[model samples]
Target: MTTAQKRSDVPHAALIQMTSGIDPQRNLATIEEALGEAAAQGAAMAFLPEMSVLLDRDRERSSHHISLESGEAWLRAMQDFARRHGIWLHTGSKPLLASDGRRRLNRSHVIAADGSLRAHYDKIHMFDVDLPTGEKWVESAAFLGGEQICVVDTPLGRLGLSICFDVRFPELYRRLVEEGAELLAVPAAFTVPTGEAHWHILLRARAIETGCHILATAQEGQHEDGRATYGHSIAINPWGSILMEIEGGESDEKDYRLALVPIDPVATKKARTAIPLSRSRAARNITL
Candidate 1:
């Protein structure tokens, strides 16, 4: 416990970039190591990349490993790990087996230092797209969309939670701001091609548009299942300035890294007042 905790109620949060594989056990081990290092470095909170629990190539086989959020052993281990470290843990995204057992839910969960569940967010937007490179994804086939937006308060600030693909839609984030979000968290397993094109722009834009600090955890490198992800975990201030980025090459598909930054509430307020994008839009009238 560092009294750095009382500094304007903002604390150091670490963003982890990982490359998860089909084996949940191995992924869990890797996460434990990474989190241990983060805790040792004096981080009060840590953000894990989306699907950091597991990534598989076979869509049907993945269902076997996906577990419901409440009763999953792996998720429990994650919670215990957080409590042991005395640090807030943001489990980016995991596959929660739906009650119907026909599909899964791409969900994110927040764990307090005491290991209690603070909030959980299911990803509303599905990544369904076809690329010219002959790659395609119909995410809706494997996972159902989430209906609600999630925001929660902690030592850091009020956080707006979202998974990958949700970042592309600005409306959801605007709604989050209206709900008093001071930070935006994006956990993603983004494809390399799309990451190269849209990763930085989409994240920075979200921070600027809402005047909130952004913590985006990511997966990088080619996985055992043959999926290649873009890995550049980043932190940005309310002013949309890049506070810190993990040391990684654009093609560092197998490299794991971390980015840590301090969040300041006053900076968010200042940026909101200076830009006022939301206020300006609210005052305008549109005719179609």
Candidate 2:
């Protein structure tokens, strides 16, 4: 058991970058390994990249594995892993059986250090676009978008949950910050082209605009489905500074990529005081 009862004065978030495959079990192995390492290092929480547990472009065959009914192994394993390690886990995103029962949704789950389910956010913005690289994504066809913006309270800080495509929308971040979110989680399986063009810049912009610490974990390298994902998982401070990032290429299992970020509430306060964007919102009526 790697659960640490003592809290560090300053929390360190472990941002994990993984190149996930088709097998959910294999991906969970990597996640458990990363959790052990993170707990050993005294990390306050661990944020995994999007599709960290499973990435299968094929909806039909993938459903057999990705679909989670009550009492599923993958979700149970994840919760138990977090509990045994005594660490908070921000799952990047996974396909889970929705309330409708017939469909699934891309959901980000927050498991507390005590191994209880704290909160969950469904991906609000869908990836429905045709990229310049000739790769097309119709996320809407497979999963439904979430209508609510979710912010949850935690020991480290208030957390705002969002998926890959949501990073493009500044309004979401602003709304989250307005709701007292000091930290933003962006777990993505971004395409290589879009990620190269806008990933870092967009993440920094969100952090600067919202006055929050942003952790964008991501899927890197090509997957079993032949789709290449942009993998440059990073952590940004409230002042829009890249504190740390992944250092190696895709599929390098020899070197586990984890960036340690200080969760600074003082920096968030200072940034908000300096900018005062919330006080100066163009639309005073928009709700999160």
Candidate 3:
């Protein structure tokens, strides 16, 4: 594993909230504008929302229209921006066509300021659900699930990687904490119904359980394709407190915004000093 440069004790990070559409070019433009704003606001690291490149509910269109190569433009732009601004860029999940033509993977990337790829994580859990509101998702039909849990060494600290639905599984977050992760990134384009119901609870639970800061960049409002997403993008501390959240917004507002949240390693250490819950779990006895 490549060692990440140690940054200062207090690091500032920003989460970029956006509602993407079917047009990849337009999405790239929006991401560029958001990153620029984040850099100007003195964010040491910036995160983008899930489906950052494109968001189409139609399985056929999503599978056939988007390609991994299509994301090259956005990746290059973000790399240059990160290098120029001297900040880390966490580009949220982009649809990548797997070697097997049958499925695509929702992949998230962490890029260093020197324009090197630090790590990439394919989303392990797929959002396959049937909702009562006539809204349904069959992510398994279009996307393949990732097998390995990913954790990356970062300038600020070790970061655990996860996408939207993966947040529902507490075990994954626990595994990441065991591997020395101090922060967790949950980039999501959550549906209106589910986001409203469980988003805050799940995020806070993961943060408290792992004793890590949670940075969740999300899609808020309605997309051009007429899909409504829950748009309260937030950053939560290890103690399960919300540091910042974007509250009121219309369904289609394209706001390029950034929030600087302070992350303290000492605070995380202090929170875990008592019982060492994560370690105790590893040593627990189980009956077969």
| Count of clashing residue pairs in every prediction | 2, 1, 2
Question: Highest lDDT: which candidate?
Answer: 1
**All candidates' lDDT scores?**
0.85, 0.84, 0.81
Candidate 3 collision pairs? 220-231, 222-251
Query: Which scores higher on lDDT, 1 or 3?
Result: 1
Which regions of candidate 1 fall more than 4 Å away from where they truly are?
1-10, 249-255, 285-288
**lDDT per residue (tens digit) for residues 92-210 in model 2:** 98888777766678988899988999888999999999988798899888888899999998767999999999999998887898798999999999898998899999999999998
TM-score of each: 0.92, 0.92, 0.90
lDDT of 3 by residue, 1-288 (tens): 111223345777877788788887788888777777767766678898899888887767666555664555667766887887777899988887876866888899999988788899999999999998988789998889999888998866899999999999998998898788999999998898998899999999998888899998888777887888887778888888887886645434454455667777676887787547856765785422
Lowest summed lDDT over 10 consecutive residues: which window, candidate 2?
1-10
What is the Å distance of residue 2 in model 2 from its true position? 24
The alpha-carbon lDDT assigned to residue 97 of candidate 1 equals: 86
Residue 187 displacement in candidate 2 (angstroms): 0.4
For candidate 3, which ten residues in a row score worst on lDDT?
1-10
In what order do the candidates fall by lDDT, top score first? 1, 2, 3
lDDT of 1 at 119: 93
